[model samples]
Target: MKAVVLERFGGPEELRPADVARPEPGPGQVRVAVRAAGVNPFDGKVRSGAMEAVFPTPLPAILGLEVAGVVDAVGADVTGVAVGDPVFGFADTGSYAEHALATTVARKPEGLSWEHAVTLPVAGETADRVLGLLDVRPGETLLVHGAAGAVGSIAVQVAVAAGVRVIGTAGPGNQEHVAALGATPTTYGEGLVERVRALAPEGVDAVFDVAGKGALPDSITLRGGTDRIVTIADNTAHELGVVFAAGPQQRSAERLAELADLAAQGTLRTTVAATFPLVEAAEAHRLSDSGHARGKVVLTV
Candidate 1:
């Protein structure tokens, strides 16, 4: 199998294309002939060794979190899903390759493209988890940081669909785009608190900080405290007494299936900012790390 391997954790250049042994599924797992892989900010952190304390990847590891592809083989104890099924989910091994192993997967809807399918697993799971954790109710006001980006955009849409009023923060270039996603758009930076306050005079019910660009202080101010505030990208979460949502606790095949169904029904919109060949995994990481990509970055096999 042709895969990009990280020889060492330092930079994007550490990821090099190599012909490696294809991964075989373990018990309760399946091997997928990957069609597309989603490049996440977490992958960049892993590649650069920033997540070592939390998600220690062994040396010479293949780095990818989510993928969409066809199941080529099923391992013992696997049920419902079979070989030849089109699926997408969390990659048990790594997804930046021609083939990867998956323990959690949902059948891909026929109406969804592989690229779009790959984007759902991580972003959908994260957004749903944070919202649930915050206990956001319909008619409540929610503030989302980085609303124009992949996960933030989905979070905004899902919250809006649930009847929550969303105030999303993004760049000036993406303000209109955020508004279109059913949120009142505000630019993130100084005066963000005032802007969000103006949008929600009753004050924000919860804060979803995906940008992690030091927005926690303002979020605390808006929410009046750190309660119901969750951040997926901020490293200062612990120091600031904010909940840093991580791990696979909220990921499941059922949730992914719901997300896939919503996306297939055109209720959930996903954007692919750019596509790179598997060999250009390094370039993909660079783009994702730039934090300026307006949508999900994908690698095509």
Candidate 2:
């Protein structure tokens, strides 16, 4: 099988197209003929060795975090899906290839394109997990920092569906787009804290910061509670009384399935800002590293 393999950790250029042996699924896993793979900042971090202190990848690895594809075979103990089922799940690597192995998989949401399905496993699930941590309730106000990116976009839609009043921060270019997702869009800038305070005079019920800059405290100051603020980008932010949501303890197959259902029903959808063929995985990473992706970026296999 042809895959984008990285023998060493570095930039997107480290991802090289090579013919590698196809991997067979072990027990409790399944083989998928990947149709699309989602490129995320997580993938970029792993590639650049920035996450080496935390999550280190085996050398000569393929890099991708989630995928949309069809099942070609199921391993022993796999029963939720069968061969030929269209499924989507989180794999994190090897998804940039034509085939992938998944320990857990769920059906793609009905009425969703494969490109959109690829965006959900990681970003969607992360948003769901963080929102769950915040325990947002109907009529409560929720604010999401970095509202225009993959996780934030889905977070806004999900919060709105749960009946929470949503306010999200984005650059001026994305202000109108986030607003269309049922959130009052605020621009993140010099007076960000003041802007948020002005909007939610009573303070927001919860604040989700995907930007990861230890910025949760600013939002928390407005909300007046550390418990109400969560950050997915910074793992160490938890020490500051902020919550982190993507480790083994937080990611779950059940939560990912729920987010998929929401996407299928049109209650949630991701904006794919750009797409590249699998062969162009390097270019995809370069674009994502810009930190200005309007939505999820996908690699078609």
Best-fitting candidate, measured by lDDT?
1
Clashing pairs in 2: 64-92, 65-92
How does residue 247 of candidate 2 score in lDDT? 49
lDDT of 1 by residue, 50-74 (tens): 9999888888899898989999999
Give TM per candidate.
Answer: 0.97, 0.91
- Per-prediction backbone clash count: 0, 2
| lDDT, candidate 2, 42-127, per-residue tens | 88888999988878788988888787899997789988789999988877347989999887678886688888887777776677
Alpha carbon lDDT of residue 253, candidate 2? 70
Question: Model 1 — TM-score against the truth?
Answer: 0.97
* lDDT against the true structure, each candidate: 0.91, 0.83
